[model samples]
Target: MSLFSRRKLSEYEPNDHQYQLNKLNFKVTKLEDRIDNLENDWECASQGESFQLANGIDAKEAANRVEKAAQKALPNELKKAFDEINSAVKNEQQSIRLWQYKLGIVNGEPQWVRIYHIAALSRELKKYGYETKLDSNDSDGRFSSLKVSWEGKETSDISKIDPAKKYILPLEDTECEITDSVTGKAISHEVAYACPRDDKWEIIYERKIYSDAVVVPGKNIISAPNWVKSIEPIEAD
Candidate 1:
């Protein structure tokens, strides 16, 4: 006979502690398998083999393509504006001497006009007897309001304000028309200054009287093939 009789199969059973231990061992084995799989994946990725996102795209390559697309989507005008600003900074131009502000977006494009440029425009406008007001908060670097008035008529529309148009070319001999202040009639006068004012020349006649300095919208006085040229960036102290 055996030294100890073998227990019947129905009578054999695992204790509570043994049962819990078996469950814990099974979970640990599963966790170790997952860690091994992660390490293998990292090794494959480092070797540039079988390392693509679920969408069949390499993560780094996808990021680079997205960045390029974003850069290409920038408008040409915006790009040119940035280049001009960068060149000004590199050359230490006076236009960028003072703090600059991006007033706002116009026609879905950003306005890169600086404070110096606005001040120059204001001075020129004042020379023509136009009242210019710059209502801006420098703290935020954006114009809170801008107003331009001529003869009691005011316009706050930025679309109507053209920096290039405000430029007064030195063509005193040019012939153009001017409106009489009292008679409200068009009078011919020698153009003291030719301004590019929205598809025409805003003519300033030789002032014979105090009120004669008014600007009159007239036909193109410049007939030279290269009459229109790029405006130089304003430089002022």
Candidate 2:
């Protein structure tokens, strides 16, 4: 029989409880062995050798002498340490203006210009009924944002677009798992790609021809996974 009760697979329990118990048991066993060894060593030492005092000095008197020596030396040592600290702080403050200017190099105009260009592109895409999506690239690279056109055709004139009416780019659904592609050994996860050609949404190209990375030109098809029998669209708060 096991030392612990058999927990059913269906039973509700904290995930790491058993792993934590195993760790605690290992630590307790190690501590017990260390304490036993220490006690044995102390008993052997006490019986094996005798302690002797130099110059016939008693233990209490010797301790008192050591205390006095420390008291005499400690104050001078402390003052030297404090003087070194004060010197460092003084030097740092004297050169602080130069240090502060070096930090300003990171907030330069080139960085601002890069950000301004990306924002301008995002704003321009919004006028063409295309919302700007952040790319999958880690550094964002040369392409700062992706222009997504779901319905095709420009939603409004570039000059007439209201900033508030701008559509947000559709975020990729992470919860959807690539079932067939992962198991069957395919390059792409997406099953199909849809695009608008003549006012009608159609699956212009099938899978294996291209990956989701190849934009469908008009719309980025992010459909529900096969595992999901039904999905309810939720309103943002």
Candidate 3:
């Protein structure tokens, strides 16, 4: 018989078993409702926890990626800036060097070794305020070697300096002498040397004195125009 089948209502006694069965069914329904509620709450809590954890993880990963990229790019960028600064400094130093070379402020003597004769030695001397001891138009009237001196306020002793090394001028011709054979006029030119040995004046080099041609300015040194006419080959007098 089906559990729902009904018997003759009056004849069936309403026993304690029937009453207990009704109470048990009611309690089971309430328990099932409570379980459903508990399950819903658990699911909600789990979903919330999952969302928070995932969000935190994703956020952390993104931040780490950004930091890595920044780290990788920083050194190269800094290096590029440093290279630019270095290049700028090099260019500035080059410009200063050019200026110093042009001004003739470079250390040491000029390289006149290759040249057999220094063309504008007299002109350079005049520019530095050293007066030419000899001046002549005729090649024969020129001084073989002119003595130059500094009449300026700041004069140095000449003996302390080496004469052989001072302003060395090469000889174009050994037989050069400054004399006006036709006019019978000869020039005895003397050059001044800024004495480093003593504050006294001394004639270190002298020439029989002859003029061949006027000295021209060289490439590396400043030359005074009209000051230096020509260089003559001089011998030790």
Best by lDDT: 1
Error of 3 at 96 (Å): 21
Candidate 3 residue lDDT tens string, 75-133: 33222322333354455521100000112323575431211011233333343334544
lDDT of 3 at 216: 18
Off by over 4 Å in 3: 1-48, 52-57, 91-237
lDDT of each: 0.43, 0.36, 0.35
- Report the candidate with higher lDDT, 1 versus 3: 1
* Residue pairs clashing, model 2: none
Candidate that beats the other on TM-score, 1 or 2, i.e. the better one: 1
TM-score of each: 0.25, 0.18, 0.18
On TM-score, the candidate that comes out on top is: 1
For residues 1-237, what per-residue lDDT tens digits would candidate 2 score against the true structure? 443544553253555677788899999999999999778778878899544445677789888876555433332322232233235445552110000011123455333122223333334334434445544343534434332333333332223223333211221121112445547653444323223345533333234334343233211122212111011111112
lDDT of 1 by residue, 112-214 (tens): 6543334433444344334667666665545443343443422112223244343233331234456799998987544343344455433344443313233
Residue 125, model 2: Cα distance from true site in angstroms:
99
Query: How much lDDT does candidate 1 score?
Result: 0.43
